[model samples]
Target chain A: MTPPPSATRPGAAALGLAGLLGLLLTVEVLPRSGVVSADYLPPTSRIVRALAVELNDRAFWRALGDTLTGWALGLAIAVVAGVVAGVLIGSVPFLRAATASTIEFLRPIPSVALIPLAVLLFGTGLGSTLLLVVYAAFWQVLVQVLYGIQDVDPVTRDTARSYNLGTWARVRHVLWPTALPYVMTGVRLAASVALILAITAELVIGSPGLGSRIAVAQTSQAVPEMYALIMIAGLLGLLINLAARTVERRALFWHQSVRGEAVL
Target chain B: MLDVRGLRKIYGGHGREVEALRDLTFTLDPGELVCLVGPSGCGKTTLLKCVAGLLAPTSGEVLLDGSPVTGPRPGMAVVFQEYSRSLFPWMRVRDNVELPLRQKKSLGRQRRHALVEDALEAVGLTASAGAYPWQLSGGMQQRVAIARALAYEPEVLLMDEPFAAVDAQTRAGLEDLVRKLWQERGMTILFVTHDIDEAVYLGQRVLTLSASPTVVQDELKITLPHERDQLESRADARFAELRTHVYAQIRAAGTRPAPTA
Candidate 1:
């Protein structure tokens, strides 16, 4: 039973790796062979060497750390604010209705569009980057948590009430468990959104991070280094996504969606 | 003792008014088991919800121990039909049973543990104490629900068609378990079901309810012996007579026309 799927996984990985290598080879050859100018598009080998050099550079490490710090801080703030607000708003019908139009009006406004206001208010600092990141990520978590609270079974709510559970006890025992899966999903989405906004703020608002470093490299015409920084940002996004999924799966092991995967 | 005096529940207002229960009245003495049987769409559930204080009646009131019920009273527990929904899926069997006790804040840790153990033992689910509700079968899940109610040590236990979702064999086993538990605990139980045979076999006095906008049509006393086996008690002549009588009452109520303005 296990052998067939396990065997197919390696086969699938080999195919994927083969495809990735093929694309890398195409990019490697295209510029060097003069199909595209080397000045505009650096060879994969040059980019790889630049990446190796950047990995050893102290300044590169500092910039990477700064970017991650901004992202982590923004995500933490958003999660706390979103969960609290979502629970409060979702539990009360009057509050939910009152805020529905306001939430709708505010939610769809892109965080990048707030970059000008953030720059005007805080200038090019961690605050500016966090403003956009938190704004974007907060909506992700808030919407998911709202959906989660609404999804709570009426029977379960009635059971809690009939048991004479206090407000805090009911929230902890019934509401929290019911809303957790949604919170996790929100966190997963917010994690990526936070990272994207953090980078965007650094790039556009001239904040001190990897995105700013990429901007500086581009301005200095260090094409290989610029490509290397972009690649690193992509890799970081991938790692954050993987980490978020692992956390979600671990936290929601009791949930049907997670448990159903195990059965298969 | 519990008294439901002229209980009326009207959902919505004015033109959209849906009358679920109209002039429903019944009384239960301490340590007595009564079953409420009715048609499919009857207000049996609404009645139980009112008595449980989960919902307020539009008119009249439920008096528990001579106090008019305003909210969920401390000495009452309910086992709903949807056992899967009622039991917290995240908690283990023992934890689920211990929840109400923890909410009450009267029992210490050791006492709570002892009660959980006793309740699980009574339901013959001591072995599955560490398991989750979803991990158990439907019948076992319902047993966990009953165990939770038992651990509460309520003066009144209201069951709302609790065994309706399980298989026939499982339902019969659950029925017997309820009877055994009722006999042992001697707590006032109000069991609601649409199954005539189940009402006849379980209740000391079976209350037959009319169709939609329900009112108590008849109440029949069962004189069967306390010591009952599933086969012998159900096969008894008195059981058949009471079952037939309740069936006729329900049938007549179902065919009856709605009252004109």
Candidate 2:
């Protein structure tokens, strides 16, 4: 049964505000109390002020835009590449078997470790950064999609076939919907990883993004600015995760877990 | 409208072979409703799958409308026992019912809507058209699955223990709903079940299968009247006789020794 509307909204609001306050306390009150060295992780007040100052700077916006572009471009590439490859690999048993060895060999090699090769190939630009993000995010999504397609209930597949639905139609209507929840989970995970790798690539390669800005602030000994950039990175990650979750909730409201009831 | 002749299936394994079905033969005319009763693992499902063209029999053939069934035919639809999995959980009930029409591609939007509405209303699920399958009770979900199958307007509907997962009361109610649909639409149906009473209650003819390498043991015509009620039919002398005959056949099947040369 659906939860009462009045109770549900206020409860959600309370939880959200509590979470916001908890983060505020961590960033502001604790540092203001002189619990740690403010030079390294300055008080939240200074960070907020720095954020306001940076918000007006054209270079700051450019760098933030660059980071988001890299993240979005890389995530889109990974989803397209991973889902296509996963479906092909999963549906074909012999191919899956042959590629199992190769995929296993390559899947474990850290994308961060490939930064040197990526740098040599593309140089320090958006291309190189996006490639690195795709590298980091693809394997996670590919594996989840592979398992998701394989885990489709046989009865459903049979039912679809029994209705004389063609292979593509069956995949679109039956396989896609059944595997979508899992794919969304994988994509959500990939978004977080993309954000991390976007910044990490920028940090490592001295690219024009938030990570590079943070590195520059650190080297310039602008401690408040560095803390401000770190806070911004954290907020970027938080926003990406929240966006993924909201999309998932809206798309999969029919899911049992989302509907919040036990099927008897 | 449908016929299965000498259907056979064998599952090959490591140094072993499982003969799931052997030399099974049955036929159904249009508007006929048949119930297949067998013990667990007796290959009733394999038989239905063969008829539905989901699995190719090792050595026999299924014919529909005088044509050999090679692959899944558009004239048939299946209602699996797991209704939750059968309907796409992400789609609304109306969308789920409308899916088959989308596959047909011959009907326009208005016609498709009418078909979906008719099927839903027939199954008493019009009120839940906007609800997801997972949000409904098990019986209601099963009804949705049936509605989906009915929406296809298939010549033959295959039900594999469609009501086994529901409560007893709901199962009885669903049986009645199915009977009403079958009488009204004249859709030929081949229903598989493990319950003997259910086989007799819902079928115009009850086909019993022998255990292990299942063969059609016997086919008995349900001579009971068409307009039957749950209470009166269960108590009627003819219903009792048919139920007793099916039960005895099943019991004999369990205890009967293997025939040898």
Candidate 1 chain A: worst 10 consecutive residues by lDDT?
A1-10
Each candidate structure's TM-score, on Cα atoms with residue i matched to residue i, is 0.94, 0.90
In order, the Cα lDDT scores of the candidates are 0.92, 0.88
Tens-digit per-residue lDDT, A91-166, candidate 1? 9999999999999999999999998899999999999999999999999999999999999899999999999999
User: Second chain only: TM-score per model?
Assistant: 0.97, 0.97
Q: What is the per-residue lDDT of model 1 for residues B1-261, given as tens digits with 9 covering 90 to 100? A: 999999999899566999888888899999999999999999888899999999999999999999998899888999999998999988988999998898767689999999999999999999999987888889999999999999999999999999999999999999999999998999999999999999998999999999988888899998899877789998999888889999999999899954421
Candidate of highest TM-score: 1
- Among all windows of 10 consecutive residues in model 1 chain B, the one with the lowest summed lDDT is B252-261
Cα distance off (Å), candidate 2, residue A67:
1.6
Shift of residue B5 alpha carbon in model 1, Å = 1.4
